[model samples]
Target: MAEQPLLDVEQVSKSYGPRKALDGVSLQVGRGEFVALLGPNGAGKSTLFQLLSGLFVADGGSIRIGGLDLRTHMTAALARLGVVFQQPTLDLDLGVAANLRYHARLHGLGGRHARERIDAELARLGLAERAQEPARALSGGNRRKVELARALVHQPEVLLMDEATVGLDFASRRQLLDDVHALVASRGVGVLWASHLVDEAEGADRVVVLHLGHVLFTGTPAELVAHCGAADLAAAFLQLTAGGGRHAA
Candidate 1:
């Protein structure tokens, strides 16, 4: 039997009244895989993330996380997924450790177990030495690292990073991307990282090009280049999504 993917989104569709934000979009992320959801601004990437995060339900189709159907088992499906949204959600006034503690508690994690997990994640992200500092005191990259650590504290089977590198400098972005890829390798965690930047998708195990609510392409970076007959991933992405489509609001 074929192994089930950790994250499976099949023919998922969504709309905001008259606008079809996502139409028949499908993708899968296996354990230990890093799948990049590459697209442009207003390409409905945010809509897809919203659906995956359970903030909004898809108008049609299904999303499964860790083999649990999201529609039938919302709590269980969500429990297996970790998410870092585009917007910063950390409380700047709180200490770094305090922030992670709150999230761990929200997931019903407590006591020594929670502490151990928190410590472990902090160490893994190289934030252990800065645990006592206020969140605002750290650099943008470190703050993002803290969020990544908090997301992993519960040991979710699938991680969703929505435009996670939006505000960081080039080096920070590169390092953060490297860190997530390392997580896939070390922990066998499935990742679906959404971004508009083509450069970020070059090193992914696979790239799913989504535009205008549709998945235009899915393959390795090299395959994408060959398929489009383009010189590089960036040029291929531009050509694949050249025709303008309705933008999600």
Candidate 2:
């Protein structure tokens, strides 16, 4: 039998009173795959992220992470996911190691094991020396790296990044993307990266174009451009999201 997908979002739907934020969206990410969630500002990407992270319950449909149903087994499902939200969650007052340690403890990791994981992640991200520095003292790129390290300290099989490169400089963004790609390549971690930047999705294994709470396209970057009859990903994204004045959910 074929193995189950690492992350499966099946016909997931959500509504806010009169507005339908997501309507029957379905997608899957296999182990070691990097799937880019491409959409405009109001294309319900954030809503979907919220649902996946269990921040807000889906009004309809189901989500399964590592073959565990989110609704029926929230803890088990969540335990398999490592999430980095758009907003920075690190406590600026705390040292980088402290912040990571706190997250590890939340996931039942501590003492020697936690320290080993923390040390490894910090070194991998090139933040080893900064481990003792306050989170606020680091540059934007380093702080973002800290968040990524903390997310992986639990050694999750799936990673969810919601606009993770936002507010970063060009170099920082590129480095972050390279880091994520390395994670997928080396660790076999399935990743669902949500972003509005077409450049970020250029090399993704697959791209799911979401618009106005609906999926407009799902294929490779080349396929997306071909489907839209555009020359490149940016042009294709503009063409796909055009003619819609939809507000984000």
Candidate 3:
């Protein structure tokens, strides 16, 4: 039998008063797959991430993480998920390792097992030497790495990166992307990375394009280009979005 997808979201919807933030959205991230949720600002990317992370319940439809229904089994389903939000959440005064330890404990990890996992994740992200440094002591890019390491410390089956590379330089963004790709290759961790940058989605195993709260396309980057009959991904994105969305630099 085929194994179930690591993350499955079916026909999800959300609204703010009269404005719909998400409209019957759906996507999946399988084990070892890196799926990019590409959209410009106001395209409902963050709203979908909110649903996946349990910050907001969908107005309609269902979400399952590792096959556990998010509505009925919220705790278990959330346990299978890890996330790095666009805004920083780390305590500036907390040591790098301390922040991760706190998260690990929250997820029922502790003692030597938690330490081992934290160490492994820190080392994996090249933050081992900065373990004892206060989070405020790190640069902005390094701080993001700490958050990424913290997210993986508990070893979740699915990862959600919501505009994670926002505010990063080109090199910093590339390094972040490489680190995540390595995790996907080595640990088979499924990732749904939301971004406005077209370059970020270029290397993903699949890309789901969203615009104005609706999904516009779902396929490989090449497929998106082909489907839109454009010269390239950037052109294709502009075509699908009607050349009038807030694309970030």
lDDT score at residue 180, model 1, on the 0-100 scale: 95
Report lDDT (CA) for all predictions: 0.92, 0.93, 0.91
Q: Tens digits of per-residue lDDT for model 1 on 117-191?
A: 999999988899999999999999999999999999999999999999999999999999999999999999999
Q: For model 1, what is the error of residue 51's alpha carbon versus the real structure, in angstroms, after optimal superposition?
A: 0.6
For each candidate, what TM-score against the reference? 0.96, 0.96, 0.96
How displaced is residue 240 in candidate 1, in Å?
Answer: 0.6
**Better model by lDDT: candidate 1 vs candidate 2:** 2
Tens digits of lDDT, candidate 3, 90-194: 999999999999999999999999999999999988889999999999998999999999999889999999999999999999999999999999999999999
Clashing pairs in 2: 42-248
lDDT against true structure, model 3: 0.91
- Backbone clashes per model, in order? 0, 1, 0
* Model 3, runs deviating above 4 Å: 243-249
* lDDT at 218, model 2: 81
For each candidate in turn, give its C-alpha RMSD to the true structure in angstroms. 2.9, 2.9, 3.3
Residue pairs clashing in model 3 are none
Q: What is the lDDT of residue 214 in candidate 1?
A: 91
State the weakest 10-residue window (summed lDDT) of model 3.
240-249
